[model samples]
Target: MNAEHGTPASAEPGTLRPGGRTARVRAAVLDAAGDALAEQGFAHLDLADVARRAEVGRTTVYRRWGTVTGLVADLLTDMAESSLPRSETGSLLGDLTANARLVQRTLADPRQGALFRAVIAAATCEPRTAEALHRFYDVRVREWAPCVRQAVDRGEAPAGTDAHEVIRAVSAPLYYRLLTTAEPLDPAAADRAAAATAAATRAGAYVRPSPAP
Candidate 1:
């Protein structure tokens, strides 16, 4: 299990999100990879091409990430590391609204939206890619899950509320809209998603069930 945190960094890239020459190389490679994915999808991604685009040596790219799955996995790791921290808005609704807005903004951005679609498509056929994608979401969910727990503590949500489920629900609709219809992911749509999820959570629809004997 190439866990998000413990995976040994190859000698070239010094640390996660650190600043220096190695970090610049990493940033360049990831930016190039993203551009390729957004423009041509995962099927066309190549390490040599990414190296060329990043203006780094092909040997470095090959040495750092041995395969496409490894590179894509690293890209997802970087994304999770760089994502904004969860907002603490004092209420479940406010917090969920903030979460939805962030999702909406990401999906509405042409590059990021296309990049997500490309990775999702790749994940369907690639086992390693799917694992990486799941890990990426897990990181994001954990980030926002604390807010739901805070809601329970504040009495804005019922006891035994499943924090992760509530967080997922808030973002699900926005991602669905982005992937399904050719609809514009506007602020109104984000607000609706937040409202719906917050309402369901308050109604105890997301309460955790006891284990069966």
Candidate 2:
């Protein structure tokens, strides 16, 4: 695996002017790559074109990202890290509602929505891209897992509920609406997902099963 693919610095354009020319060049290349990916999709992402767009050399782009998958992996990591922290609203319903709203708002944004759709389409045919996409979700799920655990402590949910899975479930419908249904990712859909998932969790839908003898 390429180090740049996993390194946070490669995900976005760096602002540190002290790292000198090399850092600036790397940042420029990465930013250009991101724009290319967002605009053209992975199939049309050309390193030479990215270099031209960034006014950087092709050798620099290749030397840093190595391949399209590597670039995409770094981009996903960047996106995950840059995302807002999970809301702590002191209750499971409130927290889940916050989560759903955040997801709905993000998926409904024009630029981000298009970028996600393109990335998702790319992941369908690229195993590495799929792994990166999974990693993005894992980070998000972990971010909100504590909320579920807190709900359990507060007696809002069963003690054995899988917090991560519960958090994941809250967003599944929103993503389904975005990818499958042509329905708008609006506040109504967000509220429905949050309410449904919260109700299911309270009903023990996410509780772990008892071990079989």
Candidate 3:
């Protein structure tokens, strides 16, 4: 799902990546699956339904994905691989602001927002989906954690700061609003998230304590 290359990241077990016809089939099936999940949530996701939407054979979907959970897991992997790379703005606030805005815009999009909501709700009860969701956020966190490291190197944040935590902080409030309230995922909210994270990070809020000898 790389935005520029459309190339998927490494396959995990049931996730397939065969070339030519197989790849096209995979893409079509996943796209159809995402559409179905977004439109009707996971409870309504069926292999036959996905097959009809994808125009691929039902056997192919069954053989490749096996179950709804497997398909959803693969979809989450594709989303992680396709997400945009982090911005390098040479400062902690600028970098986090960029990150926050990206999350805001994505959650604010109608289809993407609904898709995310469906996936998140599914994760709450489905163990496989929850693991997939965790991995998805892990990929995204790793992608942006370096910006916090850079901030530390530039003296913008203290040494021993947990870069992953700082990156998570910038997106937490945005996600909270997306799930909890009717408020719009506006740019102003994104900016506030970034600013607050930057301030807290500078105050050593995310710093890890030294390990005991």
Candidate 4:
């Protein structure tokens, strides 16, 4: 997948999100794929198994996805498309707090947390999955970046602040905790992440450095 455009090099009909009947098939297959990944991890994710779980024809799965990685890539794309939109709470802290809480809730969910772990593990060796993961986060970052721009406009964040970086900072700690420790992803942790990011953003920590003349 192209990082900038989040599209495959070949824009085939199979790659595109379909409408009507095919949309139902796509949703089923992706849900099955996610369940398999969460339960069995990437190494055991079989297309035939996913087809059976989805109650679809094996040939349909093969013809549409071709391989497990292809199916996984599409799953990540669908996840990004289905994620909740960023909150607009006027204050930068409020907006970032909303973002953090969303991340916390997602990581705290058993199925979603397991699915993310499976995908992150797969991305370690699979170049295609890695690219898909990059595109997934890229889409998310872009979605919330406008809040930082709004902060700058409102004089809450410094001028020349890197909006994308600020958005990333808000979620980075939550993800790290999810991956590293066994601590519960509580609301307090989310609030801490939001506060830290908002403070750093206002202090110009994320300001883009000017090029040396």
lDDT of 3 by residue, 106-126 (tens): 999988888999999999999
Tens-digit lDDT track of model 2 for 22-138: 667766776777788778888998878988998987776776666878777777877887799999999999999999999999999887787788889999999988988999989
Residue 78 miss distance in model 3 (angstroms): 0.4
In candidate 2, position 170 carries an lDDT of: 94
Clashing pairs in 2: none
Mark the regions of model 3 whose C-alpha exceeds 4 Å error after superposition. 1-13
Q: Which ten residues in a row have the lowest lDDT in candidate 1?
A: 1-10
Residue 166, candidate 4: Cα error in Å is 0.5
**Residue 15, candidate 4: C-alpha displacement in angstroms:** 2.3
On residues 34-147, what C-alpha lDDT tens digit does candidate 4 reach at each position?
999999999999999999999999987887788898999999999998999999999999999999999999989999999999999999999989988999999999999999
* Model 1 TM-score, 2 decimals: 0.91
TM-score of each: 0.91, 0.86, 0.92, 0.94
**How many backbone clashes does every candidate have?**
0, 0, 1, 0
> TM-score order of candidates, best first?
4, 3, 1, 2
Q: Model 4 segments beyond 4 Å from truth?
A: 1-14
What's the lDDT for residue 140 in model 1? 99
What are the RMSDs of all candidates, in order?
4.1, 4.6, 5.0, 4.6
| Candidate ordering by lDDT (highest first) | 4, 3, 1, 2
Q: Candidate 1 regions off by >4 Å?
A: 1-19
Give Cα distance to truth, residue 208, candidate 3, Å.
0.3
TM-score for candidate 4 = 0.94
